[model samples]
Target: MHLNYTVGYIIPIVLDALKDTELSGDWWDIQPGVVRLCGDTVEERTKNMDKTTRRWREAQRFEILSGWRDEIYTVYAPKGSPFFYMERSAHPLFGVLAYGSHMTVYVPATPTTPLRIWVPRRAAGKATYPGMLDNTVAGGMGNGAGPWECIIKEAGEEASLEESLVRAKAKPVGFVSYFYVRHKEAGGEAGLLQPEIEYCYDMAVEAPDSGGPTLKPCDGEVAVHILMDIDEVVANLKNGKFKPNCSAVLLDFFIRHGIITAENEPDYLEIYTRLHRRLEFPTR
Candidate 1:
């Protein structure tokens, strides 16, 4: 199963929900309306929406962000009886769950010098996942857009990557299943890489630090980033890893597509052995 690649083309990215570090974009209503909220309580914020907030308003763009809209990269309408909407000019979505696109870096297994993948550390902010973890690049729904283009744009934002960089050595593989809620506050420094929102997309690069003359980051979304070894990432994942999309879908995709024959593929061959057992990792 050779992993089918998308045509050599790139899409514009808007920010939303993602879990990777090397991507450019923003999450939900956290964008242009990321105000200080001069008030003390949610009620105050709602009131402010009516009077002030010269930029945002309900039933419109601002309202679009109210409440959590996605989780683990999956969109979900508010469940059960919610405690009042988050205000239409409100993003009523809860800010407790995890929602966004994500990428996992890895060096290919091949003769001679196979590539290695590293998922550098994101900045120390409200969005960085539990302390720090290895994730490729993930972003939000980019105002309800698709994930393919989203991932590409995210790689540029978080990784300070240029389209030309990944284009030279990257290609998108099949996607995985990522089911989640809508109002979950992603773990990381809450902010956007570019000025606009973004969608989610996943791709494979030849190396972590792969860059070119056309790639650069205008916004200070990502800190110093780097690419590391997949063996270390897999080991870390096996030992209470932060996010396992790397092991869950990415690795499997590579194998399914016949990209490389991992030496330790058998030990992790539980899909066929335990087809009836439940899984314990994120998808898509």
Candidate 2:
């Protein structure tokens, strides 16, 4: 199925779920291997899409897939055109492309000290990837927010880093793309597709003595923040201690920093190529 020019892959279970909703009624044209919103204008499409999704949410449909985030994410076409908005939880159901931003916060090595990163552990109570290590700051881009703004917002929410600090220090360092399959850790059925693009950023922070901020758990999503040197982080990555996608972002960081190279890793070329997979859906 295609949303305008953006391809959307629907699984069999998702198709069966949609058949039980208003989405299969007048709002959408649901045919085998093809689906389209049935509306003449963007406003009409958005309205009908919202109504259909809201009904499913209220009815608690797709509960087995994932819990509703209540956050809305925009589906886009080529040239950054907004096709419509859908609830965040429903995104994986339609297998639409998802956008997010991740920032790695670290203090560069000094003559006496090695480079160290601030890593956060997800709270044990969280629904997804509980107690796993995550990037210093990461979040999904929602409600039409741009990547830069999303990063800054997530920095404060996830790590209690002030916006001024992030705005002053963060540098956009390209992105990492991946095709993810959801499983128990992701709180969804096995094999649910979630192709994602995360706008990556890196921040070289000053030591706290220089008036730089120290990470603290502001939102309950984070259990705690720890400052660990490069060696420890590499060990965790090898042990699969980080969330899979977050680990991918860290691998991107390592490659960018010249840590993972031909001399060090046998599969350096393969790993580098897979980090930026050419996605099937439209990304604007």
Candidate 3:
């Protein structure tokens, strides 16, 4: 029930719910319905944790556990308890967590700097997700690991990012919980979305080195990534435009880290009051 746990098929919305709530634990989003997939096979899915996970069900879990992507309710469990355990999703040996994290990445530097950030495009033949871009790094948290550990692991898997570098730049931002229910678009209340809660994190990296490992395409559902304005890009989302899900998470991260001001209203150049503002970029 920690206010950070999220319950939703969509990770960002879950985070938003957590940010919006005043309560702190085992809570869920008040969604109208669950997400549904096309055809059979992947349809009619349910949340069934393993024996180890089932054992933890009685623990005073503060977050969601074991579920699918289009699910509604997140069977929440707390940390240091057994109500949850890790298992496979999409693949048997893939070892995705019953609980996990979703995080955001920012531009290399201030808006005035000639730096940039990238977002992934949804691929051509996606199965469930058609053309919706998502976070810079996201992954299922496994059993026995901490939320920070889950985020660090996800960064490596989703973006091929370096571990220590991610750790150095990232820190906890918030949590979200996805509740279960059914809707016309989601098929039915029985067809809730997956991953009820997403532990969120935020960071500012030192613009990645080109020679470093790049973000590998996941299952052809994602297309080539892109670079654009944080504000301009996200605004496109309202018009059905495609932007990475984690972009706003990045904005949130900046806010939590005191990087983004409450007023992006004026613009990054308004800092001229002190020609000697402590704006310095380390030369690596």
Candidate 4:
């Protein structure tokens, strides 16, 4: 659905941080209260920005890397192959909402059964969005990995899934795009811009004894994996138990699976349109 919340104005500190960088204004466009990087190709612009952002982070002492400081995420233009790599921790500081992908796994309800979904709770000690409910498998796309590759890696790491099963069963089901301006209460520096496009996928697991592997938290990032009925999932969504973006992903699942349709919802069209809101950056 279209985001019901308003994006907060860009905080001054963010702009001030970008002021002196060689990659500022010249490499990025700041207008209409939004910031977007510009370059002929993803590689050229991303490389320049990565170097500039790294140097700025070091000089400014914004050392909250939490072990992700060395990890690199591929920054893309509006679409297509990645342009370059950037330290994962510095994405928000520069107001660049890097693109990532997520997968929703479920077992279709039989005539006598109810639909069930897999949900994971973020670890309490995580750096961002700690103790929040997340999708079955979610992660940022890093350099040299495509969407499918990224999902497989995340699925194995976060949920202990077999790579062969993931490749054989995962089905890409479009994406969910939103521009989120996180407020201080949401657990980040106030006015941190997080424009993102989540390339969503769906995986239908077989019933037990069909050789489907059980899901368990293999990585410390997830505390537990809970299987909840569709009704219970919707309840959690309404109660704000799921992370905001995860909520969007689940809502999309409902729409696509015929669980949420125009006959039952008053704002069905509006919700569908809102989920794919056209972003202003990267000229996509």
Which numbered prediction scores highest in TM-score against the true structure? 2
Off by over 4 Å in 4: 1-10, 20-48, 59-68, 76-84, 185-187, 209-211
Clash count of each predicted structure: 83, 0, 52, 7
In the order shown, the candidates' Cα RMSDs to the true structure are: 14.9, 2.3, 14.0, 5.8
Ranking by lDDT: 2, 4, 3, 1
lDDT of 1 at 105: 47
TM-score of 1: 0.46
TM-score ranking of the models: 2, 4, 3, 1
lDDT of 4 by residue, 74-115 (tens): 654444344456777767665555667799988889898798
lDDT per residue (tens digit) for residues 180-251 in model 1? 222223331233111111122344545323442222233455444555555565566567544333344444
User: All candidates' lDDT scores?
Assistant: 0.39, 0.85, 0.44, 0.74
Question: How do the predictions measure up, each by TM-score?
Answer: 0.46, 0.91, 0.49, 0.81
By TM-score, the better pick of 2 and 3 is 2
Better of 3 and 4 by lDDT: 4
Model 2: how far is 78 from its true place, Å? 2.3
The residue-level lDDT of candidate 3 at 50 comes to 34
The sequence of per-residue lDDT tens digits that candidate 3 reaches over residues 1-284 is: 12333222343433343333332122222344432211122121223223322333234221233223322212232343232223333211111123457776656555566444556666655433346666666665544456788788767766666788788878786654432232322221223333234577766555446443345554444576565565555465555454322333444444554555646536534432221122111100
Scanning candidate 4 in windows of ten residues, the lowest lDDT window is: 1-10
